[model samples]
Target: MTRDAGQMPEELERAQRFAWDMESLYGDDLVSVVLYGSAARGEYRRGASDLNVMVLVRELTPAALRRAGQRARDWVAQGNPTPLMLSHDEWLRSADVFAIEVADMREAYHVLAGADPFAGITVDPADLRLQCEKELKGKQILLREQYLLFAGEPAELGGLLVRSFSTFLVLFRTVLRLSGEAGVRDAEEVVLKVAARAGFNPGALLEVHRARASGQPPRPTADSPLAVGYLDAVDRVVTYVDRLVREGGAQA
Candidate 1:
C-alpha cells in the first residue's frame, strides 16, 4: 500500500519499497519503474503532493492488466495515485501523443529499477506543440467557466486559484520549452518568467502560493485584485501560446 508524510525520508522509502515490489512481481517483464513529477523533482509538499510513478512492462495483455489492477488497488488504498502503466511497445508508439507528460518525466525522474525507459524514445516536436496549444486553450475556457460559477464565492475562488496554481506552473514550463528556454523550476521564478513572457503580473499568482505555504488556505474576495490577477495571468498564457509559430498554433 501507499503512504505519504509531512517529511521526505519515509516517503522516499515507500517509493523504494514500491520499486522493489514491482521488480519482484513482474521480474523480466518489468521494463522499469520510475518516480517522477514533484516527488522526483524534490518539490513535493506533504499534504498537497502525490507520489507519481511510471511502470513499463515488456507487453500488456489481459493477464498483465489483471495483475496491475490488483496491485494498483493496493497502492491507491494507501493514498497514492495509481502508477502510469505502459508496455514497452506502447511507450514507444505513444511518445508523440503523450509528449507533454513525457517532457516532464524527462525533466526529472528517479529510476527505481532497471534502466531508463525513455532512453531511446523520441517525442515529435509538432505533437508537443499541438498538445500545448490544445491544452492551454481548453484550460482557458474551463477557467472562464469556473470563474462564472465561483464569481460570487470568495473562498471557492481562492481555492480555485490555490488548486490550479501548480498545474499552471507545469504548463508554463512546457511553454517555456516551446520558446527554447530552460532551467527555471522554482514556482515563484516560473510564475514571474512566464508572466513576463505571456504579458501578466506575477503578484496574484505569488500571493496564492504564499497563502498555501502559510498553512492557511487563501480566501480571496471575488473582486479582489489578487483574484482578478490570477485569472488574467492564465488567460494571457493561453493567448501567448496560441500565437506561437507552429501548426495548430492559432485556434480560432
Candidate 2:
C-alpha cells in the first residue's frame, strides 16, 4: 500500500485509489503500481504537475496489455499522464537505455501496490552522462525552432519560456550530479548553483522562475529585456552542456 493517500491532495489521493483498483483488477499478476517523478519527490505543484505512475506486471501478454491500456486511458482522463506499463523483466532489462529515468525514480518513489519493482536497481553513470548530453543537445535545437515559431507574440513567447524552463532545470540538475554535486534537488537552487559554477549569470533564469511562480507573463514582449536575457541564459546552458559532452568524450 502507498503511504497514506490522505497525505496527498485530493487529485493525487484519487489517483492512488485508482492504482489500488488496478491491483484488485490484476490480482497476483500485477507486480507493482509505483508513483515516481515530482509527486514522489515531494515537489509536486497542484494543477501544474503530473502524477507519474508505473504499473509493472509479471507478463506482457496481449490480454494484459489491453487491460493496462484501458486503465491507463481512464487514468489519463483524470488529468494524469498515462502510466508506464511494463513487465518486471522488461523493467529490469531497461536500465541501460533508461539510465537517467531509472536514477531519478530510484532516488524517490512510492510503492502504491504489490512489491517494489525498482528495489535494488542500479544505473550506470556513464550511460546517464551520455543520455544527458544527447538530450541537452537535442533540446537546444528544438528550443531554437520553438522560439522562432512563437517569438513574435509576447504572451506565447513568455508562455514558452515558463513551460520550457523546467526542461532546462532537469538538465541542470543532471549536469550538477555528473559534476559530483549530489543531493541537490530544488530546481531554482540547482539553476543558481549551476550558473555560478558554469560562470554564467542566472539573473534571467531567476526572473523567469519568479514570473512562472507568480503566474504572470514572463515579460511584456519578446523584444523586452527579460525575454532577451532568457534566451541568452538558454544559449549559455547549451554551450555548457556541449563543453561537458566534449570533456566526457564518447565512452558510454
Candidate 3:
C-alpha cells in the first residue's frame, strides 16, 4: 500500500523512507512498519529522543532476519534505535506478557506502512502494572550495583544518570496510569504530575531531566546531596507505586 509522509516531520519522513526500504527488501513478507515512542506521540526532541520503529514481517526466517539485520545496523549507525523486528504471529501472541510495551505503543503510534497492528488492541492493566513494578525495582537494583562500580567518577555517574532516568520516566507513566491518570504524554510533565500525585518533591528529578536533555553533566558529584536526593526520589516513586499496587489490587 502507498503511504503518505505529507503530514509528518522530516525525521518521521526519514523513518517512513526507512520503512519503505524494508518493504523493498522483504516485499510481500513485510507485514507492517510503525513509528512509536516519543516521536509518534509528538513529544520528540530531535537530538534528545529516539525515533522508535517496529517492523513486522510475515515470518522471521533466517534469510529474512539476515536481510533485516543489515538495515538494523545502518539504522543505528544513523542514530535511531534498532528497529524492532517481530513476526506477525509473535506480535499477536506476545501482548499478554508484554502488556506495558503494547499499551505504551497503543497509547500513541503512527502506522508508516502496511496494516495497523495496534488497532483494536487491548492490554490488561494488571499485567502492565506487574511488569512496571518488576522493571522499576529491577532498574533500582541495577542502579545500586552500577553506582558502586562508578562511585566517584563524575562523568561516568552523569552518563549513567542521563541514560537511566529516561526508563524511570517511562515507567512512571504506567504507574500513574494504574491510578487512572495517563493523560499527559510528555515525560517531564509526567514526572511532575506523578510527583504531585505521590507527594514527592520533583526538583531533583527535574534537574536530572534538564541535565539529560542539555547533554550536560549532572552538576552534583557522586558525594553531593543532589545525587543522594535523586536516589531518594526514585525510592519514593517505587514505594508510592508499591502502595498503589497493594491498595488498588492487581486488576485496578
Candidate 4:
C-alpha cells in the first residue's frame, strides 16, 4: 500500500495543539511525542477512532505519566474528544502484547517541542526477523493442534472460527515483529511478506479469509477438502518458518 502524508482534522489539530500546550506547561522535558496506532496508519475514522499518541520523556516519573493520562482523559471528557496520551517507555515495553503500530513519519513528524526518541534507536533487523520466526512457529504449532481436535466437529465451528482468528492474529504479530516499525492493521498488507519470507503461499490463506468474511463455515474435517487444504497450508507455514530458522542459524 502507498504511504500517504498525515492529514489532521480540525479537532485532531486542536487536540495536538492542546498536547503541545501541556508539554510546554510541564517544561520542555518532553523528549518526543509521536502519533501511533490506526490513526497513524491512516485507517482511523474521525468520529469512530480516538487519536492515539505517545509522549516520551528522558525520565518519565510514574506520577507524571499518571497525571498526563488523567489530563488527557479529562480533556476528552470536556468534549474536546480524543483519547490521546501514552508514554513511550510503557508502550515499548508492552508493544509485543498488544496490536499497536508505530507511526511512520520520520521526516515530517511534527516535533511539537522536543527531540525524537527514535532518532538513535537502532533496531536490529536480523534480531527482529528471528524473534518473529520463533513466535510464528509457536503459533502455527498451537493452531495445528487445535484444528486437529476441532476437525469433524461441525457443532464446534464457532470455537474453531475464534481459533482461526487467533491464527491471523499470530501471523499479524509476526509481521509487526519482523518490521520492528508497526502500523499494519490489515492482514492483506503483511500476509504476502510473511508467506514469502517463510516460504508459504498466501493465496490459500487468503481463501480462508474470504470464506470467513463471507460468513461461510470453515472446513476443518477430512471430509471437507477446503478445510484439509487450509490445514495443509498452515502446516507448510510452520515447516517453512522452522527451516528458515535452522538455515539462518547454520549460516551464522
Clashing pairs in 4: 219-227
What is the per-residue lDDT of model 3 for residues 7-63, given as tens digits with 9 covering 90 to 100? 768888889989899889989988999999988888777687899999999999888
Please give the CA lDDT of all the candidate structures.
Answer: 0.80, 0.78, 0.82, 0.53
Q: What is the C-alpha RMSD of each candidate to the true structure, in Å?
A: 4.0, 2.5, 2.1, 7.4
- In model 3, which range of ten residues has the least summed lDDT? 243-252
Tell me the tens digit of each residue's lDDT in model 1 across 1-252.
133333547667778778888887889999999999888878777777788998999988889878768778888998999988889888888868877788867888888888888788766667778888788778778877888899888888877877787777788888887777755677788888888889999999899887776656787777889988888888888888877844343211
| Cα TM-score per model | 0.90, 0.89, 0.91, 0.54
Which regions of candidate 4 are displaced past 4 Å? 1-18, 21-25, 45-52, 72-113, 141-189, 196-234, 249-252
- Please identify which of the two predictions, 2 or 3, would achieve the higher lDDT against the true structure: 3
Count of clashes in candidate 4 = 1
How far residue 78's Cα lies from its native spot in candidate 1, in Å, is 1.9
- Candidate with top TM-score is 3
What TM value does model 1 have? 0.90
Winner on TM-score (1 vs 3)? 3
Superposition error at 215 for model 1 (Å): 4.2
* lDDT for 12 (candidate 3): 87
